[model samples]
Target: MALVELGRFNRNEAHILIGRLDSEGVVAIPFDGEASIGDGSYLFIAVRVLVDEDDLATAKAIVESAA
Candidate 1:
């Protein structure tokens, strides 16, 4: 499946955005949102928006104004 990243949101913001998408019936998930640690380690507490290929434009548009 093709995935597009919409925005890099803080943990709370991401959840709110996810709630918005969920309401709109768009299939979305949170991806990598974090600070990297030493030795290729990633610490993800926040969430990055991920959507299907077809949802890229819409998702980008939605989050564009969200920031």
Candidate 2:
């Protein structure tokens, strides 16, 4: 399945969002969470939260409701 970005957040937030999505039965993943770590600036990079393209709509709704 094609993965589409749902949003970008800090590493902790990204993982939290992934857990929320998973609880709702949507498979989600975090990308680039460790990028820039060589310089200890990983937190400066926004981690991407992605979900299956087919679940994008549902995922969006869930996230919006959480906000």
lDDT of 1 by residue, 43-66 (tens): 444577888999887777776766
lDDT of 2: 0.94
Estimate every model's Cα lDDT from 0 to 1: 0.74, 0.94
Give the alpha carbon lDDT tens digit for every residue of 1-67 in model 2.
9999999998888898899999999999889998899999999999999999999999999989989
**Which pairs clash inside model 2?**
none
TM-score, every prediction: 0.67, 0.96
Residue 47 in model 2: lDDT: 99
Error of 1 at 17 (Å): 0.2
Error of 1 at 34 (Å): 8.0
For candidate 2, the C-alpha RMSD (Å) to the true structure equals 0.6
User: Model 1, poorest ten-residue lDDT window?
Assistant: 37-46
Give the count of colliding residue pairs in each prediction. 0, 0
- Top TM-score: which candidate number? 2
Tally clashing residue pairs in candidate 2: 0
